[model samples]
Target: ALLGDAAHPMRPYLAQGAGMAIEDAQALAQCLSVGNAMVPEQLQAYAQARWARNARVQARAIRNGRIFHAQGAVALGRNLSMRLMGERLMDVPWLYAGGSEVHGFNGNAL
Candidate 1:
């Protein structure tokens, strides 16, 4: 199965490419460790485990690219929001949590 950039091809705005690749390896490892499943099934399981989180990260990266590259009123708003919220505005709890809720793999949440 495709993994990391091959799978998602995200921009660097979120700085998640390496992290996502590591996560992909972990999920793929977990899938391959399943005793009963065939290789095809394991690969499918890996896809199921990773797809949504990867998609979310990719989308967020795109949004961050726009935000980082904003100009005029958008840039002003972005700066104002940053000033008001500080780093809390950049907090991504779901992502930081390793998306366990979305990854019920090997009888354990990722």
Candidate 2:
């Protein structure tokens, strides 16, 4: 099965490529660890668990790339928003935290 950049190539906007690769490895390991599960079942489980998360990250990365490369009024508005709520915009607790237990993975709480 494809994993890492081969599975989900994304722009560097969010700087999450390596992190996602690591996560993919961990998830694959966990899925494979299930003793009675067939190879196809494990692969399916891994894909089902990771596809949505990877897709979301890929979409966010594309959006962030657009924002970063924006010009004119769009750039102005983005800058204004950043100035007004930079900290809130920068903080991604849901992306950096949550959802580990759902997959039976012990990821960092950060």
lDDT of each structure? Answer: 0.85, 0.79
Give the per-residue lDDT of model 2 (tens digit) for 10-83.
89998889888888887888778777668897788788778888888899999999999999999999999999
Model 1 spans > 4 angstroms off: 101-110
Q: What is the lDDT of residue 108 in candidate 2?
A: 22
lDDT by residue for model 1 (14-48), tens: 88998999899888987887777789988988888
Winning candidate number (TM-score): 1
Clashing pairs in 1: none
For candidate 2, the per-residue lDDT at 6 reads: 99
Clashes of each: 0, 0
lDDT of 1: 0.85
